[model samples]
Target: MAVDLEPLDQALETAHLPALSAALVHLTGETSWLRPEWRPTYTPLSRGETGVPEAEQAKMRAAAKAAITAYLTGKAPMAAIPSPEVLHQMMNFVAGADIPEGYGDFLTDELAIDGHSTKDPNWSTPELKAAARKLNVLVVGAGMSGLLAAIRLTQAGVPFEIVDKNPDVGGTWLENTYPGCRVDSSNHIYSYSFEPNHFWPQHFSTQPVLLDYFRGVAGRYDLKKKVRFETVVEEMAWDEARSVWKVRLKTPSGIEHVEANAVITAVGQLNRPRFPDIKGRESFRGPSFHSAEWRHDVDLTGKRVAVIGTGASAFQFVPEIVGKVASLSVFQRTPPWGFPVPHYHEDVPEGMNWLMEHVPFYDKWYRFWMFWMVTDGLLPMVTADPDWTGPTTAVSQLNLGFREMIAAAIAAQAPDRPDLVAKIIPTYPPGGKRALLDNGVWLDALKRDNVELVTDAISEVTASGIVTADGQARDFDVIIYGTGFHASKFLWPMKIKGRQGADLHETWAGDPRAYLGMTTPGFPNLFMIYGPNTNIVVNGSIVFFSECSVRYILGCLKLLAQTGAAAMEPKREVHDAFNIRVDEGNRLMAWGAPQVTSWYKNEAGRVTQNWPFALVDYWRATLAPDPKDFILTKSAELVE
Candidate 1:
């Protein structure tokens, strides 16, 4: 409510008026405010098609600009909440889904906006802060989720420490330095809901920009002071008797132990890189490294390179390195399905950037646009139709149409290169694997004379080169493992001992499961962010999910503080029931498609990585932790 007029004037001066007007219209829900001529001509344009011509857009922009200037000069406080009808209309416009029963909650809880009470409970309250201060919370990994947890905890006046294995923040962005390593998700929505950056250079921003953004977030919140860099959590034992967690930390100096009341494991699934167990991999004389551990020093100019595994990372880096290498051999175990994205590599236009920074609610509305675009967009395609017969092409009619669109895109991109087309089109369902974004660069790279897409199974990696199953040995100067990470392995390497000294790894037995992907039955006062079955492969941003998880964890802590409880864990029956429902839901998803093999699944063929439900479903589940679903032990009982 206390906005400076100067900032508003700067925004209004060069603001994209059409976009600004639309944002205000969406936010205020005042139809009269936007003239008929200034309104958007197209509601939902198909992919690759431009909507609303430049001439019409210019006119709208001019009108909207004038209107914003008038409103700013009048010095009106922006309405904090819209009418119920306006809210409903906004929901319909943004989500493109039927207004659900708890649509208002979805706006506040999921969106984390000003309309509702999404803020953390008053931990700053003297008694609450005193109780929380007495407790020690250890967060593992100073990544996106961990940083968020720290920020929330700091705001809540909770005492916590962060131990990250990496030297700095930005876990994935810090590690993955592979060429063309950029996010497939839209940059606008990929970030934290509360921390929107309106001036991203690229729509799908590269790793460096992302890393910088994270560092900025960490710096802004003063989170770096609380973090112990170059430290790893080796083991964590929940001392149920003492109602505390004894965490064994591995640091550069020596091993250390920290006793904490609770632990929030923000160590994400994609942190650990998984390399193929190829025979004679060690015998290779050439410099070989996983894409995550990219060797930037090694120059590939005029050198032959072999890129193994055509997954997301490989798909990105291969295109970038193809031109540099004299001959590039891409070994594909399974081809990835590329989603059509015309603006994947395009820069965020200056006009749009101005609109985002200057225009009132424009950034928020833009984020809403992005959120709605991905939410439930591909659910139908990924949801398997048992009655439908065609397995090779797609899962259903809609999915088939999607498949046709992309496949045709590939063909159109490389009409002369049929061999590349055959090798490129994935045999599995579209959403079975993480869908990649393509703007013709990947297909164009494959059509180059120096590039070869090898669909052969790698037999062995000889000192000279790699040998295929067909007994053909191809020589290369360098080998790059574009293979992904150990995603199914949740909280890996850390020997977590729960109640009765139950090893966390042994308990799961390679198939990790968590109740609502946050709490386990035995791990008292322990929470997980971006844990098992919480990975967003298709719909929504992982950052959004992390926010949800952190809030849920905070809610649990709030419950403990309010009840004077020492510790709390999910009830066994409750945890079991939640997982059972998760399993049932996953059975209907594309990841559960019998023939598909992806990182999403564990060794047991169970979907241990993905959230089968929509983002709203998860939002509702994490709104608060029910006391009935948890076994709460009072502080008095613990003392006794």
Candidate 2:
């Protein structure tokens, strides 16, 4: 059943309305705007029709008026809202509505006035030159992050060069060109907030569209010129004698040395693919490839295919290839929680786009609604409930409810396959790991006669087939590994050196940690973007976190220019204290729970990946750099 106005009304009735009204007024400091819609009464309405009634409009208006009056007259209740369901449903309605054309243009104009635009008065060419003279910045991996750094540095008048091993600029978008590959995040939120794309063809953009967006961003900002594509930085050492980074870089042609005052490592975690080390992986004779490196030349029609690992990439690609392949063998590791997402494939109506584009305050409110729904509203569900008895595997009561909903969906799709249901049901909490969206297609694909779901461990890869631990052999013409990435490893294969020539990998010891996921103590003037513990587990855009990191990095550069500082790094004590706080915060979250074994935590049982706070909290913390947290050195001073 589709979600409609009835659920909202029932939710409101179940919730304490008077308390919610009082809380809304107190939160917004506006009593009149906190009123309910007059046309929609408190009664539940039917689906697939307009629920508002003219007859009850006056009564609803009176109720809202009374609430507003009571609140304004200082008679507001001190009690908090019993539940947020009503507000959550209201936000869903707001988001489901139309977005107007030219919405991006309007936001751009406003941002221009606020000095946040790329063409703002504060971003003059002279400022860029001044920053260049004072600070030498090194940008790692010339993908989205590197390009963005170059643009910001150029705008701020700072001199910087982008280094990347690949010959192209698109990071994951460039590498992962598999069939049916696309972005799961909405295109509106995926693109940079400062550089919004008005011409996205799909609401959920494809890989090519995203690649084009990155290319366009680079060209528009003149960042391509500063990027040294194919040049890889082998090692970066903090030179105490000169108070500069000694960068050893390798190009296809030869090696080169450069000195930089600051470094920004934006290589990101998902760049490397992690393949499972099966006993006889090397013996596969037909064809084997990771989902990231999909081979298009090998057609799937009438061909037997063995797909290993059921993760996010597999979820997207499996449905796409299920119909084409003759027989399919799916290897199961752990089942992911699937949430019903109605608009996962629905197009944005022209009227909705119009409202988003032309209607003042509409787009902002819509974005705010999304932010609340994904992050603030969903974050609470990530905690473990000590009193819940429904399932020990599920994190909380709310999460258990979610698991039931998903189970119902799976059952509806695969009525004949109770065995498959048992295999696919997750024993862990709903939000313990990444939650995938269901369009009702995956289960249908699995129910196909040609499909096989194998739960046994892969024992070996024979010359002609794969043998499971059960001693059963399955012949396949192709093998696809959707085994995911080495997420907790942070920076792998890349050797980074800091003070005393300490190797970064050796220091991390397989589990990476960073102060605020941006800096390490010994790595003076070096910053890591999208570093460990910076990943948002709840609802929020990764782009939002990236922007916050960018702001902090910019602030550091500004300080260097203002003080002629030779080097700056977070103080050892401050770094340790911040890590302690992060660990303490994680202890209360689901990732830190003893039984959970998600990639969010490392082998040492440390929650090294996810951020344990709300998006707003991180934003407030990183809005500006705190000089007190860093060890700053003047250009004239020499270190002992």
Candidate 3:
């Protein structure tokens, strides 16, 4: 049955006009919606003048109506939209129209359509399916990566089971339940592309909303049926005799063994928190806990509170608790670069949400805009500046611009506190560390009479208070450690024995390395998602990276099936060469600059955390694993 068009039209009346208009333009390459007989040109506009031609205004308007009508009536498909150049021009026209608050500009450049079609002739779908049917797969960690791996495997008709140490799903989100806990990434881009969410309440979704989304996804996909919760994989040993992974798991009742043809380690980096070892920490009687493990029972009303570490979690929680505490002291290790974000807290308007819910292409376009702004468009600003004048400040011209803007904002907010300004102002280049967003609310909270910003190092924790390095003691009833995670330690607390009894820890020597951050040379039939050097510090969504990793892993599985191979692992030479390239790339970026110190790099000063390229680069690199990169092994029977 054909759907009615009247309701959709009525919905569009109250919808985001600009977004709808852009969709119309994208559907019908007619600038005539604005100026009828006139075709658009790409000439730069002069100062104080509109570039749009006035002569063909009427014809363009008529063309726009015709185009929109065609799209609504099933006369045209979105893929049939005119040439890319013309479509872009139409998008600009739509953006210039009357639009809602958050729909300022149409950003389509950030879309992850790298011109690689899913229906490519090179994709050996049949062979891959055959390979997957013969193997049993084991996935560790029921977080975003693991859940995603299961979904992809299910779609490919592959046999797999997911396991997590936690009682339920939603890994980090399940654990970190602190006040004002939320995601810094925009919600649209933070979600999986296959399962785009249209119901995000805010641009930056809070922790509960994110956790609920993950839960809903699991339920909808029936992933919970295959997941073994509260069960930990104690150790995994490669059985050379059988050519399989013998996994030892410990449940509440007893130990169990499971054998699988392949293993995927999706254990994320942010699961473990690294607490600062303060002298006499154990002696102090005050309540102490990491921010990830927030104790809600401890009442802070009219009580002295001390927050150590100025990382992301601290930034969010400090503002929330400042008003409740009798006195608040925030200890800073190093201040983060505060980026200017205007809509961090603004609620998504009802009208916009309505449009996203009702309009056909509205949500997709919005997600595309977010993808561009937060990922691809922001990459250049993260690179180091070799020609900049100041060595102690921004690394490049673009980085300097961002620094100057942020500094001006800080000065404007804290006009009375020059001392705080000097302390908060970062000496390193912009994007040297994780960039933070503030709506002047954090600064306002700091300016309160009861709040104090402590820049000194902690000498020790006494029975009743904290002692600074200068021998000054300040009393506090509670201490919260926002010291962040054990990020550089890739897959910690897991004992993995690879080929010939090779321990994973001993192989990497406390510095984990993987080829394309997905597979290691000695770890046969083992894969990793979001592993070393795969962290998207500057330009991409973790979801995007995970999807790319899944695609590559699927490709490897397909290759094994085609060749009747029992196991596959990257060659040592391939792994080493990849790491050398990653090292060289990191050295040229701002993270390697001498004046800056960031967690992105480990103690050895090697960037074990971030991918130095644009998200698109990673997408292209991991689109499919190169056959030459791996060492294929056949079963003994086949070899004989």
Candidate 4:
């Protein structure tokens, strides 16, 4: 084989040495490479820095160089796949944690260790294929989850159509086009497990790159041809007689009705932007718009701007626009907790990308390292310890450590500005709300000469300016509302009626509950993608959650096919029991604290938006649908 040894050796210089060490173990069966002194030390911030000393890193790199050369020259043979016990130990060593359980099989499939998808549908027989093909399904919102649903459905030979109000594939990525809009999660694991992109420009890619990734995936899978662009689902009702869902759609031309055997709602939790209802909000005279609906036509150069709500969106965009705006005043409802991440906005180095693109198993092992880090890495820090009678600002001893990390980051960023630091630090415990990825740029933006971080409550917005409770009025040419989304209102504004003429909205009463964040008691033959309580507070990407939820939905469909059942819904008792356990579990989570106010909780104070369990638990529950948990029935035609 023809290979350039010089470039390969050079590339190893920039490689993540621990991930490379793990990959070497998988390749050459060299357990000695994973020495105790070379193991990584766990830290949520600055994840790229494995605590392996400089001497150990150099030794690891030298060993990798020799192994790769031998393998390329046909002198060394790849090892047979390791047993479960060995695999589990290797993962624990690479992750720098002794994860109590074995998720080895899960890691193999999710990370594609063997370089192929093991999660695709297994309905291969002609009979099972026929059963799958006989069904018609409708998918709402052609986003990450919807496109994933389309791919899995197509593999099953099932007939399905996708619809989206926006004329695009990415739901959040397409809509939120504000300056510096990018995914906070690392892009390597934030992507679909089936199709990994080895060449993301940034570790956390910007909106355009992310949108292009989704759009490219949609194109590769031929998903867009099956999707009806500019179409909206207005309402859906279950037809108990036909065992179908009567879905009403409004197309670009006119309104129309369609019927489907099942429906999957992938609209997601963050689509609709929420603007605060400060008095006279509509009275702003300048060009005012929500961050989701960005207006690039209106320039901000030399213009005085008033930004409302310093949430995640503002955290990203404020830094991008602070230099251009003449004067900036930021209104903060509550400060967000952000930890310093050096590569949050940095580009993927060319040599590192070359290593991934060229090295056989290097990218997967690298991704595995990141996935393992976030899988359950931070849960302990944010978990509430009920027996602790300490400060209200922190939930547990571990949580206090995380809080101190953030405090240290703040002090390092702005040592001279004590007054600013006092206003910036959050009073609530860490993980009470969304934790942001900061590189000290957000504080740098806030400390600019023209920028003012206003902590005072807003009194009202007049035709020309905003009035604060402190009796100060600020005038500006533009107002940007970064108040975030209506996250608690899952599946909002859509009219859905289920069995017994059950209204889904009225049934929820603003407190949405589902058996497993997918199916409810009355919603037979319906599945939600990013449904109630499925959002993660301090864990990995939501894409992982979507994959788990879609797998469960498919399991439900396969169950229907095998039993010759027309419909299946979670049993009322089962649904109620599961939710009761969820509430109890959430009561021990930091996000569920009484004083913490966030989008995770509904107006009624129920934790309606977050999953209060381990990442592996969701994976296990959604692996396959249990027959005992649901009520299944045959349709009239099948009953005969």
**Winner by TM-score:** 4
Candidates 1 and 4, the one with greater TM-score: 4
Best by lDDT: 4
Ten-residue region with minimum lDDT total, candidate 3: 41-50
Model 3 TM: 0.87
| Candidate 2, 1-640: lDDT as tens digits | 2212223333333222323333343334444433345212221111112243545434443454455345445566433321333333333333333223323333333223233542222434565456556777889987777777777777677778888888888888898887767776666667776676644666667788889999999888877788788898887788887888888899988999998888899988787888988888888899899998888888989999999988888888899999999999999878876666545666655434543442223344445445545665566777766565656677677766666776777677667788888888788876677777677777777888999989888898888779999999888899999998888777777778888898988998977878789998888888888998998776467877787777778877776666567778888899888889988888767767777787888888888888888766776677668888887886546322
Q: Tell me the TM-score of each prediction against the true structure.
A: 0.93, 0.82, 0.87, 0.97
Model 1, 67-115: lDDT tens per residue?
5565556654455556556655555544434556566667655454554
| lDDT (Cα, 0-100) at 4 in candidate 1 | 45
Off by over 4 Å in 4: 1-3, 114-118, 636-640
After superposition, the stretches of candidate 1 with alpha carbons farther than 4 Å from their true spots are 1-22, 26-29, 33-59, 75-80, 94-101, 110-121, 635-640
Q: Which RMSD values do the candidates have, in order?
A: 3.2, 9.0, 5.6, 1.7
Candidate 3 ranges beyond 4 A from true positions: 1-22, 29-128, 387-389, 636-640
* lDDT by residue (tens digit), candidate 3, 1-640: 4544444434543343434555555455444444322323321111112234554444434444456556667888765544555545544443332222222212222232333333121434676667667889999999889998888788777899998999888988888899988887777778987677776789788889999999999999999999999999889999987889999999878899999999998988888899887888887688988999999999989999999998889889999998899999999978887665667876665555655654456566566545545655566776775665765687777777767877887778888899888888888877778878777777887789998999989999889889999999998899989999988887787788998999998888868889989899888889999999988765347987888888888778777777787888898898999999988877667776767777888887778888887666776687677878888888643321
**Model 1, C-alpha of 591: deviation from truth (Å):** 1.7
- Per residue, candidate 4 scores C-alpha lDDT tens digits across 1-640 of 5666667867888898777777777779868877899888866766568887899888888888889888777788888776677677778777887866657778777766665554677888888998998999999999999999999999888899999999878988899899999998889889997778988899999999999999999999999999998999999999999999999999999999999999999999999889898999999888999999999999999999999998899999999999999999999989999877877988987778877876677787788777766657778888999997889999999998889988888878898999999988999999999889889899999999999999999999999989999999999899999998988778888899998889999999989999899999888999999999899987479999999888889888999988899999888999999999999988898899988989899998889988888887888888889999988889543322
Candidate 4 has its poorest 10 consecutive residues by lDDT at 631-640
Better of 1 and 2 by lDDT: 1
- Name the lDDT value of residue 265 in candidate 2: 93
